[model samples]
Target: MKGLILAAGRGSRLLPISATRPKHTLPVGGVPIIMRAVQALREAGIDDIGIVTSASSEAALRDVTLGSGHLTFIRQAEALGTGDATLCARTFLEGQPTLLYLGDNLFGDSLRPVMDALDGADAVIGVKRVPNPQAYGVAVVEGGLLRRLVEKPRTPESDLAACGVFAFQPRVLDDVADLPPSTRGEIEFPEALTAILARGGRVRALEFTGFWSDAGTPRDLLDTNAYFLAELRPRVQGQVVNSQVTGTVVVEPGAVVENCTLTGPVWIGPHARVSGSAVGPFVSIGAHSHVSGASIRDSLVDAFTRVQSPERALSRAVVGRHALIGPPGEEGLQLVVGDRSVVRL
Candidate 1:
């Protein structure tokens, strides 16, 4: 089996943060989100992978995913839909059963079961019960068999939403290629699955009740960061001078944490500098960022960002790369600053 990751979404919902880089290139627990997906695919024993990316994100995605595997990058001319994105990689699929993972969906569960489930099945759709089923592709299952797939139905039949991961047989590519634009005017993957079901294709529903996030918005990013950080193992490869570091903290090499109080589940990326700060409890400071005289918690400061002298604490903040936040703030700040932005509070 092969792996196909569709990373071509424009990520407009994550704007400003995604202004400079694709959200897939953004870090979660000091690793790029796309790379995490790659790891999951690799763990399933699939080495040959095809990544479909947009024109704007292709270069950046290549930079982060370099040397990861036998990766073939395909460019989707437009940000159509997941089905269109998959169609862009038809050459890579090459008549092999494929594992299709949405680039932005972050699933913390094992994917080997999904791989194992492809036996004698035309497709396996991963489904999880979500409160907002109408917002996602809804899966209607009866007797553990997928009866139909609907793309954001007006009235959802079930709470089981398609979780953006699927195992497809070799002929599924032909099915996806023959798909037409949905009412949303884009080629949707769910519509193709629904078509497959209409033709009596063997489709099974796999229920996943673990942590899964599309990571499409700021809140999703922070939540995904914290969820992954909870599994962190303490490894201090950098200088921790005169600091009170506790819990599951990882200070990467070339980083310096001086005179700071770092609580658990905090990640200080390589070459990041933190001084006179109280960082922790689910915070990820990106590579080469500098945080000084600030108290930050439950936030993500992207690579090359600077947080200086914020009198009040920062919580639930998602600052993008090369951002300059501060001088000081009168009260606690909750920000969603974009890349290369300068915010003086």
Candidate 2:
């Protein structure tokens, strides 16, 4: 089987940060969101991976997946729906079974169930029982089969929201060709599944109860980072001087934390420095980033960023790569901020 991840959508909800960077480009526990999904697909023994990305995000996506060989990148020329993104990989798919995983979807555990379920069903969808199914694409199951599927229904018929991971046979490509634009003006993928049912094709549903995040918004990005960081093993390979590093924290080589008290479930990337700061519980400090004299928790500081705030309490903050969060200078001051960056006092 092959693996295809759809990452063509413009994450409008995660604006300011995602304005330039794709939502899946955001890091979760030092690993980019798309990289984590790719890793999961690799662990499932599906190495021939095809990523469906927008023309704009193709470069950023490729930069993160350098070492991952056997990857085929297909750029969707337009901002199409998930259905179009998946169909764009038809040449690479070649009628073989393909596991379709949404780029932003994250799971706390392994994706072994996806491969196992595809053996019996013509199509297998990953479903999650959520509190508010109206906000998600939900699957209405009858017996063991998916009877119906709805995306963001006003009154959901079921609480089993489709978690954006599915195992699809080559028949879905035919279904896609048979599809027309929905009322919302996009070639919705759910329409393809509906076509499958109309053709008497069997589609089963697999329920997953693990930690999941679509990472559609900035808040979701922060929470998902914290969730993944909690699973890391404790290892401090860096310099910790006059710092109390407790719990399951990973201080990678070349990182230095001095005169700080760090709590568990955190990861400090290589060459990162945190001095005279209070950071903890759920945080990830990216490579070469510096955080000093600040109180940060449940936040992610990306690579090459510098944050210096003596009494600022930063929680649930996502500092993007190469950002500067310190005070501005006057004599020879220079500010080189990226496009669509956010700056707030």
Best by TM-score: 1
Off by over 4 Å in 2: 327-345
lDDT string for model 2 (56-112, tens) is 899999998888776899998887687878878899999999889989999986787
Question: Which residue segments of model 1 deviate by more than 4 Å?
Answer: 328-345
TM-score for each of the candidates? 0.94, 0.93
In model 1, pairs of residues that clash are none
How many steric clashes does model 2 contain?
Answer: 0
User: Candidate 1's residue-wise lDDT over 257-285, tens digit each?
Assistant: 99999998999999999999999899999
lDDT of 2: 0.85
Worst 10 residues of 1 by lDDT: 336-345
